[model samples]
Target: MDINMNEMIKDCLFFGMVISIFAYGFGKKLKDKWKLPIFNPLLIAILTVIAVLLALGIEYESYYASAKYLSYFLTPATVCLAIPLYQKLSLLKKNIKAILLGIFSGAMTSMGSVFLLSYLFQLSHEQYVTLLPKSITTAIAMGVSEEMGGIVTITVAVILVTGILGNMTAEITCKVFKITDPVAKGVAIGCASHSIGTTKAMEMGEVEGAMGSLAIVVAGLCTVVFISIFAQFM
Candidate 1:
């Protein structure tokens, strides 16, 4: 009977959903209690699920087979960021120049820094391309990676780690540098880390959240264009 149950769980269609929900719920609980960006619910949920899968000796393919459905909504979720941007239209309008400058500079820095490091480290062409769009959202980054002949899985992993680090360190870094401007905070986080970092911006304040949201959109577009052109030369 126990063996049969284990087999049934393995083949269960809803098992992935169950795991995702459980992991997210547990993560949310920890975030509520700890109130630290390092305890970000998404990060916690991902780590928890990975640990569970490894402990259960389950293959990633088996889990992803059932979990891929959740990924279908990523595009829509990315689009939904416009809500906050719309709400902060006046502020956006007022600081259009600053916002654009910050976004453009940050986007370029992300690409340039990666290129320089990849070259300095003597990384292969594939590795360089895969890490190029690490600062963008996964949906756009994966597309860029595919076009650049990079490994999609490696791109995704790099994006996640970049976002987690950005979210975890943005505040402390800001304080150390005495960056108290709301727009600056938002733009810095959004451009450097994309959506994951925007979560921390949102927690900081409405202005920061709005700017961060706007930064994600602008930076994504900029990265797509720049990476495409850069890849042409590669």
Candidate 2:
């Protein structure tokens, strides 16, 4: 007899909750105390969790089965980003042109540069399509990736990596380039990375977070629009 899928999912969820707390605590310590370059809380937690489960002879497949229900929240969780955009409506109106230009340019630069390089590498159609949405937010990127027959998991992985890197380098890069405006910083995070970058922006302060939130919406819309055009011509 096979194990019940529902019960399996519960186990995963329970473990995930525990792991997340561990990750947070780990990240917090890194942020507050000794600043070690090797302190990637998520990475450390993920590896530790996986190793513990594996050593205990727990099957990964069973864990995923139980957590499958939790995965249902992914799309909706991403869609909720619109709330922040609505909050910043007034600010957006004040500098609409500059914000729009900055966001669109950043998004185009993100996707275009990836496409070109992937093309140079002779990537397959599916691989190229995957990169197209890498600059957009995770939720929209997953939806777009699915629509274009690209691998959603691959898109998600790429986007996460981009977010981590973006968050890490944003401050340094912005200062070096003299990007003194909050709007520009926000757009840069959303376009160059997406949700992960927002986390970094959040640490910067309220203004930065608001801008990043708004940037996510604009960047997602811009990618959809421009990619559609690209598809029609190519």
Candidate 3:
């Protein structure tokens, strides 16, 4: 019976895609109805998918086999972010120095905080490296984790949590910190949260979206270089 079920799931090539879309759509509906940050569509969708998979005894590998196709669009989607950035090119160029400095500072702060916590907690070297790239996008973070001999799976999980937290708290944090500058808001969100957080940044405004998109690229590059140097210490 189990073998038959597994085979049935495996043979249904669209199963994962269908489930993912339906889950996200349901999540969106809930968010629209609630208009609450806690009703975050992505978070709800993730939880819903996990629940369904567990309830059905579906292996993640089978689900990923079909769902992986969706990831093919990730790069293009990221590139599409440049559209807003292009619109705000004048603003970006004018504040290029400040923007670069902000992103660099944010990246350093993220890594430094992780290092300090890891030291305080006495986490293993592998664990420390796994978390070092937690604030960047999945693609870059995974590569950095692997290069630094960290657990890529853990790094991905950390990245997701980091992004979600950033997404959920960005506006509140800005208000509390009195960060009124749109560019600063964007840079902070993108640098700390990567692509997932950028979604929230986009909703904030076009200028915020543009700066957040720019931050993703610049911070990712900075992390790549910084991680390489930092690994020498480990």
Candidate 4:
């Protein structure tokens, strides 16, 4: 197999863009079909990208080469979440205790669950740490995984799956529990699910959307602190 690093990088970017578009198209179809709870665009995009990459027998390194530049945006995109939080400052101040506790608990549970489950399976050390930040936002989770000497790529997959599960279940959980308050609703989804859950909350209405946006930043921050505490204790 002839492998050119430059060519591989270019291919990653090209395929990543193409798959992302396909996922967007699929999401529109899903929305039209009324599969509201399960049809998250990020989930669609991740699945589509994986399928295409596998089918084409392409190496991820090649694609990353071309796509690495785009990865830089992850940081700024995370920072942009501040806009939504700022828009709802009063709302945050009103429920600061619940928001902080709930997010911190959810974040801890997410990581702790992955850790316990993977350990029981006797996975390799690399696999264990790679899955550590599975519940947090992707950019931060991946960075943490790398710093912890884990596989960033695997951690990305964990984040995607965790986000999808959170997005898919938030509505059902809320409904079963008869949760009507937008603040509670948003916090539940955002803390448990992250961005995908936030997207689902957006479809709910302004109140829920605002709350969910707050969830994203709060949960992200809480997750960071939770991980730090865990590291210190360990």
TM-score of 1: 0.86
The clash numbers for all candidates, in the given order, read 0, 3, 0, 5
lDDT of 2 by residue, 125-228 (tens): 87888878887787888888898888987887787677778888989988999988877787677668777777778778777887888888888988887886
**Candidate 4 structure quality by residue, lDDT tens digits, 1-234:** 877544554645466556567777987788678876556666676677667666767666665665566677888887786776788899878778877777777778877877678778977767777877776678677777787778888788777877778777777899999988888888778777677777878877777777777777777777666665454322
Ten residues in sequence with the least summed lDDT for candidate 4: 225-234
Per-candidate Cα lDDT values, in order, are 0.84, 0.74, 0.84, 0.73
Candidate 2 ranges with C-alpha deviation above 4 Å = 1-49, 57-59, 228-234
TM-score per model over all chains:
0.86, 0.79, 0.84, 0.79
For all predictions, the C-alpha RMSD in Å is: 2.5, 4.1, 2.7, 3.8
Please give the distance, in angstroms, between residue 94's alpha carbon in candidate 1 and its true position after superposition.
Answer: 0.8
> Order of candidates by TM-score, top first?
1, 3, 2, 4
TM-score leader: 1
**Residue 34 in model 2: lDDT:** 59
Number of colliding residue pairs in model 1: 0
Model 4: what TM-score? 0.79
Q: Candidate 1 residues 131-208, lDDT tens each?
A: 989998887888789888999988988888888799989999899989899999999998898888889899899888
lDDT of 3 at 16: 84
Instruction: Give me candidate 3's TM-score against the actual structure.
Output: 0.84
Error of 3 at 1 (Å): 8.7
